[model samples]
Target: MSHSIEITPIDDQCPLLHQTKKDNIEEAGKINGQYTNKSANHIIDEKLKDLDKYTSKKFIAIFKVNVGLRKSNPDAYTPMLISIGPYHKKNPQLGSMEKYKLMYLRRFLQRKRGLDVEHCITEIEKLKGIALKCYDDIENLDNDIVDKFSEILLLDGCFVVEFIRECSGMKPNREDKIISTNCMINLVLRDLLLLENQLPFFVLTKLQYMTKEVDEVPITKLVKETFFSILPKMAHASYLEREGDVKCIKHLLQLVHMSSHPSYYNSLWHVQDLSLKIISKDQDYQTWHANMPNVTELCEAGVRFSKVGNTYSDLEDRTTLFDIKFENGRMRMPCFEVDDVTETLLRNLIAYEQQTCDVLPKHFSDFAVFMDYLID
Candidate 1:
């Protein structure tokens, strides 16, 4: 006969386990916390007092990209020409653009012929709490936090507003550096849309309202004009204006994502189940859940592909980037033109969709997965 002996678990507070808070308590005492006997629960509560700041909904929008995702391609998410917001404000490489920010700020102040710079600064200061809460990694910044953050928002916000206004129609000075050069304009446009290079949209709106011309056009109108001028020819101003004005734009990238959202997908797919059933020539029950046949396989099976016309006014009520339809052995898709910045645009968009998946439907992610399935 054999007997089993049960092993008892050791306490988390046991000194032998080397998990007790004694050392921490001694360190705290050395820092002048005075002597006291604190329970484990109390200690843990103290340590996690600021936990809710991170978990709150107010702070959920902006975040650093996941390490796994960033490691895949750091350059895709990093800003190239100029940095915006607190995350990249300290990068030495972007220092060259700082002078332009101040220049724009001076121009913005001078535009209204008595626009108080202090008034703009005070307004940005009021938003410090809300702005700080939007960023997840802002706490990592070193000293002079208040002044540094306020200055960043003030400078970057003014620069973006002025840049957009100039791009829209405001004639720049004859010697304007960025606006005069097409190459620099394109680079700055790309930089503004990076995931890590962003400021909360409200900040921009506030600055625009504070310094807008007496009969200034709507900010949305200005944004569309600027984006339309630089966006790829395939996806022009009409494409970005599909959804009209969005009510809850988080940032520039999010604005672009919203504008590029496919209305066709919105009408057909179910959010609860992110899969759709597509009837193939061989099978009627084929869903996106399975390993679907590739494009070549479908073509070999007697499927014909055609490019849909770009003008959506004649076809449907709305235009979409991912407009594809299959019927009567024919697959019709909207023409997509790939340029140099296309990959960077799509990568940042996919990153945004992945990060905000909890609050946002995975439009770009679904499109990417579908494209992968078709190509692979």
Candidate 2:
């Protein structure tokens, strides 16, 4: 009985079993395909809905420093002692300056007798939405109610106006800590120049008009004198002198930008000239890596260095910082001064120009790229 047992293979006995298995697999694949198609369609519909709801507006100008730039020098992009806008409003390290802001606000209000704090808050409230739109991330701003946002705008705006006024030789009231402390004032100045720590230009302008004295100096003049005083005497003298109207400025950083290149702000001749020169010469403007020699190498190659008048000179012959000439193996360039605040200052200006300016000549970004070529 044990030797008589024989078993046939299932495939040989019933070939239909293999066909049925194949059919089941194909059916499962078809169902999965339908499900995948439905999912893709749903995703496309959602994206279309988002596109339809999107509205174009110029609400963001100030941006967080790019990670690459920030990684190079974190302190250059950070606000150490003070916060100006919604971006850094909640930074605990900057919390100490809140009291100083209030102190400045009090002095600001006292400038005009019988000017209620509520009045300033109300004025800021009127432009609150527009002001908020001028920032990149507004979740922190929107999370707060109107009252809180208005107070912040009013306080920060007035503090900046008063600080600039005080720095411009308008004696502060009763030895103000911010004005009296040299180290603190320097920190505040650096903080103000930060890209993230900024308010809308219109907000500052509105505050200026409200608190302007009968014979007070213009706000632009005061700001230029106050902020640029820290640099060398000739740092921004020519540019500041040439600037006419600053009402079109967008922020503190933009003000610095215009102060740096007055000719660019007033006219596009320099930009056109640069574009033509680069295009005609077939220079590698697109890539940072080129056959550019560094300062040391150029010196060893029998190139003599002579200092030009200004980094931002508007002479018809020389228009930009990159207007270097190597005539007869001698190089003539505008003297560029580098200092502790230079990186922070330049980084903020570049960020502002890249984000806010509508014009084609991104002079700051272009200059940065040019510098990178030399350094690399």
The total number of steric clashes, by the backbone 3 Å criterion, in model 1 comes to 0
Candidate 1 has a TM-score of 0.79
Question: CA shift at 217, candidate 1, in angstroms?
Answer: 1.4
Q: What local distance difference test score does each model get?
A: 0.70, 0.69
- Which pairs of residues clash in candidate 2, taking residues 3 or more apart in a chain or in different chains? 59-133, 59-134
**Candidate 1, residues 1-376: lDDT per residue as tens digits?**
9999976674433343245376675555535544455555577787799765454655556778888778878888888889988778778998898888988888788777667878877888998888887776666676575457888899999999999988876744563544568777878898888888888888998888886777888776677667654443224434545445544778877776666655554465332132233333343334445646668987888878887756433223344555666667786766655766777877888888888855456666766776776788
**lDDT of candidate 2 over 53-146, digit per residue (tens):** 3333555666777786677778788898988877777789888888889888888887888898888877888998777667765644556633
Error of model 2, residue 15, in angstroms: 28
Per-model TM against the reference: 0.79, 0.75
Consecutive 10-residue window with the lowest summed lDDT within model 2: 311-320
Q: For model 1, what is the alpha-carbon lDDT of residue 282?
A: 46
